[model samples]
Target chain A: QQQVKQSPQSLIVQKGGIPIINCAYENTAFDYFPWYQQFPGKGPALLIAIRPDVSEKKEGRFTISFNKSAKQFSLHIMDSQPGDSATYFCAAKSAGGTSYGKLTFGQGTILTVHP
Target chain B: GAGVSQSPSNKVTEKGKDVELRCDPISGHTALYWYRQSLGQGLEFLIYFQGNSAPDKSGLPSDRFSAERTGGSVSTLTIQRTQQEDSAVYLCASSFRTGGRDEQFFGPGTRLTVL
Candidate 1:
């Protein structure tokens, strides 16, 4: 079973627009959520992250809105630029267990920003 | 500071052949992880190593897949009898600690193609 589920396998937006990617998870033990960005032929890079303690966290143009009760989180890119075109992935990690700190990733979202 | 790195950025091999992929973690990082990303799919966890503890290999797909971390810094993932379905990008990551709050630094993955 896929632990984290992401929607909209592909997304296209004009420059300066906002692109939102959402993810949902069923495991309540997940205490950390993070987003990663990857370009062609490269590994995914950390984009942004959030903890269940806060409802939202923003870094530069990236924002992570997390709803603990809903078991959902979304990534919003403000003033999206053409350079933001890449694959985005959402991941979760549990605090403890045999799988402690091992990330469970969601299906990736390929985002394209047209200039 | 140097980040995680994987060697043989791309590999092509025939079925039934054996292949080995390597990862060098950032200096002093205590946690290492391996993941596989199939085309247009989410990352599937493969294995994890933390300190001197036995690795968590539960995510390994089959008996043919095995990984080892030597001296707590370098890792090698070996696949015996490669199959076409094994084609994917194998990513490696390292974290400063095993806590859920620590950010993982990823390496440029090794793309393996089994023909």
Candidate 2:
């Protein structure tokens, strides 16, 4: 079973617009949510992350809006740039359990920022 | 400091051939993980390794796929009698600990193609 599900398998956004990617999780045990950005021929880099305790987290132009009750979280990139074009993945992890460090990833979303 | 590094950046082989992918985690990181990314797909968890502990291999697709981490720093993923469906980018990541809360540093992945 896919523990986490991501929507909009592909996204096209104009430059300077907000590109939002959403993710939902089925397991309540998951307490951490993280977003990664991957460019072609490169490794996925950590963009931003949030814990269940926080409703939202902002790191510069990247913001993570997390809804604990809904078991959903999203990544919002403001002033999107063409340099931001890449695949995005939303992942969840369960801590305080034996399955720690083993992340459950959602299907990736391919983001294209059109200049 | 160097991030995670993977070897054999690209491998091409015929069906039924065996292939091994390698990963070298960052210095002093206690947690390591393996994931796969197929064409136009999201990251899929394969296994995880923590210092001196047994790895979590629940995400492995089948018995033909196996991984090993030695000295808590390096890992190898071996696919035996590979099939075309097994073709994908194999990624490795490392974290501070076994818990999923820590940020994971990822390597540029090894692309394996079974012809």
Candidate 3:
């Protein structure tokens, strides 16, 4: 399937807490997974990405944990802040065919971080 | 700015009308994609263009939705007989290439309201 399922339609967290968003895909052809962040009145932006080859990838306060065997992956914010409150999306992409690399995004998770 | 840009930041149209949204991708980028974002939902892939090859229109939701990229640069997405379901933010993204391509930069989406 081209669908990427995501969990927790919405989340609320306090400052310094960790907010986690999970995603799973059934298509084995998908090799690239990326996370995007969207704020009000703006477009989604590339936050971080990971390849199945690695189990984890970290950039700044964001980290991606991948479980290829289970066809699942997740994003963890090390220290959540009010500014980090936004809609987070998980997307999967395949190299050939299958929409020609167009990303298949999950139902986004709206995260709210209380200061 | 040097980033991807979109026109008609906000568009309100009556049902059964046709609306056109334009996008200007960054220079030197060869791939462009169109997506629809309904309220509180993930982005739905619509179409993508790669170089001189024919665009991948498989993601288009229906025959009323069409897109055109002229001179391999600017793109326009046209939605005919707009329905309330078509009320959403239309986003445009551009990447350096396709197939394991580089990061896609997104523009401030056009908020399309079909009344």
Candidate 4:
């Protein structure tokens, strides 16, 4: 079963636009959600993260809007630039039981910010 | 101080051969993980290690795929009887602790090609 599902296998946005990537999870036990960005030939890097308690969290131009009831979360990149073009992955984890810290990743989305 | 380091950025081997990929995590990080990314596929979890405990090998795709962490610092992924289907980028990541809740630091990854 696909525990996590992501949409828009690929995306393209003009510079300075807002690009949104959506992810949904099926397991209610998951509590932590994180977004990662990866460039070609590089490892995925932490971009932003959110917990269930908050509806939205923001850092700089990156924001994570989480919906607990919907079991969905989305990453928003404001002022998207050419440098923001890369692959994005969303992961979930449930730290409540022995399965704590085992991340279930969503199918990645490739973002292309046209300059 | 340096980020995670992986050896042999790229490798190519013939079918039925064996291959080994190495990963050196950040110093003092106790949790290590291995994942594989095939062409056009999402990151597939392979294995994980925490402290001295036996690894969680649930994600391993087959019996021919195996990984080990030595002294809780470095890890090696072994592919026996390499096949064309085994060609993919193997990624290694580390965190401050296990349970995948902590932010993971990923290496550049080793690209493997089996012909």
Candidate with top TM-score is: 1
**Could you give the DockQ of candidate 2?**
0.82
Question: CA lDDT of B67 in candidate 2?
Answer: 93
Give one digit per residue, the lDDT tens place, for model 4 in B72-112. Answer: 78899999999999999999998999754588999999999
Over B17-47, each residue of candidate 2 has an lDDT whose tens digit, in order, gives 9999999999999989999999877888899
User: What's each prediction's TM-score?
Assistant: 0.98, 0.97, 0.97, 0.97
**i-RMSD values for every candidate model:** 0.8, 1.2, 1.0, 1.7
On DockQ, the stronger of 1 and 3 is 1
| Whole-model Cα lDDT of every candidate shown, in order | 0.94, 0.91, 0.93, 0.90
Off by over 4 Å in 4: A96-99
Among these predictions, the greatest DockQ belongs to 1
At residue A18, candidate 4 shows an lDDT of 95
- CAPRI grade of model 3: high
Q: Against the true structure, what is every candidate's RMSD?
A: 0.8, 1.2, 1.1, 1.2
DockQ of each: 0.90, 0.82, 0.85, 0.67
Rate residue B60 of model 3 by lDDT.
Answer: 95
Residue B28 of model 4: what lDDT? Answer: 91
The pairs that clash in candidate 3 are none
Best by lDDT: 1
Residue-level lDDT of model 3, residues A1-115, one tens digit each, is 4479998899999999999999999888888999999999999999999999999999999999999999999999989999999999999898876745699999999999999
lDDT of 4 by residue, A1-115 (tens): 8889998789999999999999999988898899999999999999999999999999999999999999999999999999999999998888766346677788999999999
Clashes of 1: 0
